[model samples]
Target: MHRDQPPLRARSAPELVPSLFLDLDQMLDEFTRLPIRARFRFDPDMPAVITVEFLAERGPSLVWLLGRELLRRGVTAMSGTGDVRMWPTLPGGRPASWLLLESEEVEALFEVPTAELAEWLDATYRVVSAEAEMDGLNWDGFLMELLGGPAAASE
Candidate 1:
């Protein structure tokens, strides 16, 4: 994480989702702030998506929150990809596995049992951290832009 990274602020779900979808550079900036490692993949036969690996050293609260959000947005559990084993000097490094969340996968996974989702969220939380908060940027305004509306920037 950068020393000057901003803090995480409370934003509505609609406000944040658009940022994840359009602001690639800002999303990358936010991703780098977390201790966990993830990758963006696009296969010709499959929809483009990201694969996140929850690593150790990240705070559990953060991981759980991310897991919950991912689950809410339809992320899926992956198999035969690889195992999540512990690495030295990392947090929640062990006992983790991969989740492959395609556009459809996310839609279906979002319909799963909340209890199961919570469990996964807890597991990921063991090593994740919350993203840095934005100060002047009004995330809601950015979302409006994605909806084909004018973006009303904060003064």
Candidate 2:
């Protein structure tokens, strides 16, 4: 999924903000069931075609999976808190491309994209999947770390 260029801002105001709830299982399921070809466009005149098969082939990368999950769930709108900031180092103690999802209530960030996010999704997926397999852990736990959601306390 190679985007022709960087994502261009919409000519008009952003869409209405919807009440958001994080559902990781649902997000993963949706990604798995994605069609062979998906199109995303800020404007109807210009749409980027994403090859779902390519992403699926590589398996899930934590960063790419988070990006895809956020995008699929329509979580892109920046809340006007002005709290979001980019750090050279991520909270997970690694230097990876990512975006900070910040607010007064939460201190977490996810991957950012060098290319169009859609394309980065596929690239990261390929790398992360291989890394996870090599590390001998299931992708789910690795994904949970990258996502930074509520983790159940170990008894």
Candidate 3:
């Protein structure tokens, strides 16, 4: 519910992705509660993340950079950067966060982007919303799936 809440744990990467998909619709509703607008633009050619520097070229605004990255990766990612006036030491160091969409529903499609593109988009919204509700919920597991998994942590 709240951003600080503990995350739901899943046994495997596959499980996690689908769960996020299921939560997408709910996530959209939660985002609307925020002061700023969080909209997803679908580009058939791109996945979700665009080049980060490309965003900087346009302007320093948060929205532009985020939107570009989302388009480039085809997955949802978010980060923050306070202007120098706010936190001089942390300029452009605002926390970076990302979420991967691996919906079982979407993956099951016979086509790359099935007619359920809208549903996948909605699932992306949910992944973002849930992450917003929990600050400590790192996207580690999701990232592992993208890049290969790492060795087990030493006890």
Candidate 4:
């Protein structure tokens, strides 16, 4: 028998400024619309890797909280061969954009206006979300056909 995991609950707000919290909330909302690909590497020398891709049905609240915690500790950007990317939104004139592109071997920072950041995030979210939705539908069809016999195959 298969059992569904319980829903995740967000932690209480950290001691961040109000504006930072607002920005985090806005970004979290956008992130929830798309699927996020994450990879964790525990050993630097080993080829072993763990990867997870989260869809809209599974929220990334923990990711958001971790980003906030990083910001609180004064981390602006981080990237490596790992599959996860974190963009910690900070106050003041700090860079509002951070990207960890593991496949491209890239980790960078961008200082852009808030509106521009939001627009970029929205565009990326739309593209990724659409792709994720299609992938999910395809997987569902495959499973149905596999488990339900020939009658369930798609035309």
Give candidate 1 misplaced runs (Cα > 4 Å).
1-94, 104-137, 149-155
Clashing pairs in 2: 97-112, 98-111, 98-112
Instruction: List candidate 2 stretches off by more than 4 Å.
Output: 1-82, 87-96, 118-155
- Candidate 1, residue 84: CA error in Å? 17
Top-down TM-score ranking: 4, 1, 2, 3
For model 4, where is the 10-residue window of minimal lDDT?
Answer: 41-50
Ranking by lDDT: 4, 2, 3, 1
Q: Quantify all predictions' global Cα lDDT against the true fold.
A: 0.28, 0.31, 0.29, 0.32
TM-score of decoy 2: 0.21
In model 4, the runs with Cα more than 4 Å from the true position are 1-81, 103-114, 123-136, 140-155
Name the candidate, 2 or 3, with the larger TM-score value.
2
Q: Residue-wise lDDT of candidate 2 within 1-155, one digit each (tens)?
A: 12223223333212422112121111123234222222222211111221221122356522211233344222234322244333232345432243344456654443332234435444433433423423433345445445663352121
Residue 89 shift from truth in candidate 1, angstroms: 21
TM-score to native of every candidate shown = 0.21, 0.21, 0.20, 0.25
The residue-by-residue lDDT of candidate 1 on 1-155, one tens digit each, is: 33233323443332212112111111123234223332222111111112333333446411211233343333233322122211112234332222332342221111122233335344433323223212334445445555555433222
Per-model root-mean-square deviation over C-alphas: 17.0, 21.0, 18.2, 16.2
lDDT for model 3:
0.29
Clashes of each: 12, 3, 13, 0
Show where candidate 3 strays beyond 4 Å: 1-111, 130-134, 138-155
What C-alpha lDDT does candidate 1 achieve relative to the native structure?
0.28
* lDDT, model 3, position 127: 46
